[model samples]
Target: MKVSAEIAGFMKRLGHEFAQPELLVRALTHSSVVSPTRPDNQRLEFLGDRVLGLVMAEALFAADAKASEGQLAPRFNALVRGETCAAVARQIDLGQVLKLGRSEMMSGGRRKEAVLADAMEAVLAAVYLDAGYAKAQAVVLKLWGARLDGVAEDARDAKTALQEWAQANGMPPPVYDETDRSGPDHAPIFHVTVRLADGRSAEARGQGARRSIEQAAAQSLLAQLEALA
Candidate 1:
């Protein structure tokens, strides 16, 4: 099959040309578009996740020689999280190349954070398979860019931070509840509220799974608390 000009342009932005061009096609295909002959990116995404984790771990280790594993752990989590991956995907316009089924397209799958993030991971695996680990590393490092530079300080887990703040004030731990779930199953939006013991609370919306939405709600509450302080 011929690679479309759009895919070609995506390859240019991704900074890696595939030796096995079909892999690029597979990486861009969403599970929603399954067929007997066409494989989706799920397998590739699984492999890419591992590759991303290893790269981030090594980078964090070298960047901060004095940081304890406790410190590095959050940073590592921040780097490989779906939100971060989606952010990087947005930066590179990865959304422009995603291949979704009709139903997914109608639901705005291209713009969904979870979809984009998974596609980004699959793309990384495509690069790894087409070239090698070195090339894949180069693509990831270049794409991640400044995120790696500021990861240490920005990596503070918002949920952890907010919990500590509550405990310091002798309040019970925050409670998070999923207030609502909307959209299709493949691309749900979670609305979560984080409430402190004293009833001060805030809600936030996030795209993807419930855990990330909970984290986002905690972050939102923390920001409001800081503003009041």
Candidate 2:
């Protein structure tokens, strides 16, 4: 099948040439643009999620033969989370080739973390279907290169760490409040504040998802507390 220049460029960036080019096209199509004849990437996303999880789990297990399951779980979560997937998508400029609907495009769907992450997973499924598990594993490892090495540090949940710090200092757990929200419904920005019993507080603003924003706020508060120590 003939592929467009844009898709060709994207293939170069992705480091995988699709044998079934239509798979890649479907992978790039979002739910907003779905029809009876033209399907979306949701099914691909589901399958790709499992493929990604298996790859990461196997890689993590092999990388650290001595680490406990507890130690590895958070690391796996850190590597496969939407935020991390979005980061990988951004690295490959995946958003540039996405086929979004008019409404989604108007709402900045290309830049949205959730959209990018889901599309990234679908692309992985496409690659898997086009080639096989070996090619898909190689692509994932290459794209997630340094992240695998730094998974240990990244696995530390800032909110949990902050709460532990507060408990150790004889203070109550910190409180997180959603101070404000703005932007369109499809892509809203969240402002969150985290405060401890001792009045130490920090605020942060983030886009895409509120939970991620809350985590960012917690991380900010933790940083401030650590700096004063």
Candidate 3:
């Protein structure tokens, strides 16, 4: 385990004191660290994923008392998904906290979306375990509320684009599938399948719901149109 005053500052911004800073550090430590007792983030990644989701779900439910679980569930999944977390992690310089061997560091571990997403999840887990749900919720809200809202706005644009593309080509609008998801609550991976009217399929991933499905749809449409040409 490693600790530094510098890393403490990073945690400070996230608004929690680690009950086990080692876990927090391990969450940031890549597989490439020193050999003797090096620990990677995979295990913490597992815990963080669940913690992240619960917090997001709680936030959604509390914010909108009138929204039924059926209505709120998908939105909850979207906000805490992996791609969104990775994007949020990027925004907060989470990569800088990561500990990698010189080789991994130079090769751009900092820029790998999956790694960043995992670290974010681990940190969120640590937050939940350390400070409990309420404080963890606050940290996440400050970090992600505007971003989730933006994701919703992007959803509207995606469907509009799909519609326009369909009408222009005289083709039927696409269909979307919720294939799979991974990661903890704060960050998950949503796999979407988009099918054309003719039964062709295209798959895509997004940090959140509507965009992920739209990506699937857009990819399918593009592939179908390309084949026709």
| Number of the top TM-score candidate | 2
Give candidate 1 misplaced runs (Cα > 4 Å).
167-170, 177-193, 203-217, 223-229
Query: What is the per-residue lDDT of model 3 for residues 95-181, given as tens digits with 9 covering 90 to 100?
Result: 888888887777667777777898898888777777787877788888987965554422333445666676686778777777887
Instruction: List the candidate 3 regions with Cα displacement exceeding 4 Å.
Output: 34-36, 148-229
lDDT of each: 0.89, 0.91, 0.73
Q: What is candidate 2's local distance difference test score?
A: 0.91
The per-candidate count of clashes, in order, stands at 0, 0, 10
* lDDT of each residue in 1-229, candidate 1, tens digit only: 5788998898899998777899999999999998999999999999999999888888889988999888899899888989899989989898888888998998888888889999999999999999998999999899886989877565778899999999999998899888899987767888999999999998889667777788878888988999999
TM-score of each candidate structure, all chains considered together: 0.85, 0.90, 0.65
Name the better of 1 and 3 by lDDT: 1
Ranking by lDDT: 2, 1, 3
Candidate 2 wrongly placed segments (more than 4 Å): 164-173, 182-189, 227-229
Q: How close to the true structure is residue 213 of candidate 3, measured as C-alpha lDDT?
A: 57
lDDT of 2 by residue, 1-229 (tens): 9999999999998999998999999999999999898899999999899889999999999999888888898899899999999999999999999999998998899998899999999999999999999999999999997999877644868888888899999999999998999988777889999999989899989777787888888998888887888
Q: What value of lDDT does candidate 1 attain over all alpha carbons?
A: 0.89
Every model: Cα RMSD to truth: 3.0, 2.2, 8.7
Write down the TM-score for model 1: 0.85
Report the candidate with higher TM-score, 1 versus 2.
2
How far in Å is the alpha carbon of 210 misplaced in model 2?
3.0
